[model samples]
Target: MTDFDQFEDEDDTPKSKTQIKREMEALQEIGKKLLQLSKSQQKKVPMSDTLRDALNEADRIKQHEATRRHLQYIGKVMRSEDHQAIEQRLALFDTTSAAYNKLFHQLELKRDALIGENSKEELANYLDEHPEVEDIQTLRNLIRQSQKEVSQQGKTTNRKKLFRFLRETEEKRLGLAE
Candidate 1:
């Protein structure tokens, strides 16, 4: 007897390969018909605004799901036991962090330029333009007050220097005469 006959006898239930393929194809066609019927029913149903919003949200969620899968793939790559893969992932992380820091620093510099210097006029103008910076007024006032004090002190020191020079010259002339 052939191996096929040895595996199955007349009493056994036997399905030919062609019969199995045809059955599978028939089931697939039925599934497609069912899917089409469901789709037609869905089209017939009226969509409410809330349902439309929910569907939009669902689309956004699906997009995020795709992103999550991509992140998982990256995680898997990072989690690889291979030394080269781990090192590559770590290098990528470091490079990304450095780039972020550089970009942040550049943004900070731009923001600082917008704020301008600590000059009183600049501060006042900025405060006038951006009322949200009211908290900075106190610090600005302090800076202005300190600057005034320093200017006053400088004038006093200059006057003192002139006075001392005049007094010294007079003393030197008096000594020459004596």
Candidate 2:
């Protein structure tokens, strides 16, 4: 048989050089996406400890060319990981996802509950449940300020602050904080 005929008879066909390059580029893009995620967001993503270290190291590199080289290294590390799983977790961060919306509303509800009519009891219970809250006085003050804003038709600055505090507390509790 001719060389071309023998090659065609093989069950496994080799990918073209262009196709291999495209795949490597795709993986590199995935690595870039992982780098773009915030540290808090990265905590939620599933990846090897090695890959995580590589990405963290990339964060410390300030020069453009050094960062580019680190990105390529991250891409290489990503090759051994389950990229699909990483992408799935990343998708949860999208605002349109039901999971994202649910967590957001839950945090808002907790914020409102803290500032509700029975705020004293709510605050007590919340503190008991989340001992990670280091500054109880600040939390109490924010709740009081939020309550005042709601009663006096003031701007929602304090309410927003209270919500942020609650969100950060939750993140710390879940080990998702930066």
Candidate 3:
């Protein structure tokens, strides 16, 4: 049987010190990761008052040993709580990061297509997908400006603006409220 299976059996067997220490270390690692998260992201993590306090205290601490001790305390609190739920919530932040990366790449492709020879077809496709985008005339102007700037001055001032506009519009398409 696997080591974990032995712990699950009906027989009354005490876990070894090594197993206990390993679990504590793993929990402390999770606590450290939580501290590394941005304030807004950390706000979304479900945790008890004690655990939250410990994390806040850890943030204030600059000393190495003291911060390490606070982390251990946070791990102790974690042991008594449902860390699985905490982990699942933390995993959502990772998905958000991935989603943003994918969205940015899609916007980059749209910007490239908007400047290409088949730009009319690309613009039509974009309008079809985002009918609410009322600034078709503006996008067209920006695209023309971007091309002129690139061909003449070798600059991308209007091109960057076009990309920013595409990024914000795609954010709405992705259902990211504002």
Candidate 4:
């Protein structure tokens, strides 16, 4: 048959063999990332029985050679499934981490300010912004205790308690917690 006759009539353009190989390799990378997820997170990804079994087996294997081989099989299985959906779930985990880190740094800065000499005014500002926080005197005592412990070079348990309280209070305000 002639070269043009040998080509399938179904498509306007056929993908090169190298392009198909790259696509398969990209799916393999996604499968590797899926292996890094927690078991519950793994379950969130759509999976065929064969793909599920492959992932479970991969997780339980400590041997490098076996894991490498199983991972290749996972890529083959993933080819028949909706890999894009699984990738979207992974992307959500990444986005939340960046936002969580920003909030954590902000809380740390406020916690440090509360343990400093000018804490009363700083604490009042926080209270003004969060009037839902009752028992203001309890927080005052904790701050006093934290400062005293710092002066004596003692354990900063009260300081830690104040930070946790601040984080939880913020979580409640933002409706991220009950």
What TM-score does model 3 achieve against the real structure? Answer: 0.50
User: Which residue runs does candidate 3 get wrong by more than 4 Å?
Assistant: 1-34, 37-57, 69-104, 130-137, 150-153, 171-178
What lDDT is obtained when candidate 2 is compared to the true structure? 0.82
Candidate 3 residue-wise lDDT, 89-171, digit = tens: 56645656565566667888889888888888998898998997978899999888877876697888899999988976864
In candidate 1, the residue pairs with backbone N, CA or C atoms under 3 Å apart (3 or more residues apart, or in different chains) clash, namely none
Residue lDDT tens for model 2, 82-122: 98888766655677878668878999989989889999999
Roughly what TM-score does model 1 have, to 2 decimal places? 0.20
Q: Return whichever of 2 and 4 wins on lDDT.
A: 2
Q: Can you write out model 4's per-residue Cα lDDT over 1-82, one digit (the tens) per residue?
A: 5323323336767666676677768988988988888776676666788888888888688898988887788888887788
Q: Candidate 1: deviation at residue 52, Å?
A: 23
Clashing pairs in 2: none
- Candidate lDDT values, in order: 0.39, 0.82, 0.78, 0.78
> Candidate 2, which segments miss by more than 4 Å at Cα?
1-46, 53-92
Model 1, stretches more than 4 Å misplaced? 1-70, 73-118, 145-178
- Model 3 has an lDDT value of 0.78
**RMSD to truth, every model:** 30.7, 7.8, 6.8, 8.7
Residue pairs with colliding backbones in model 4 are none
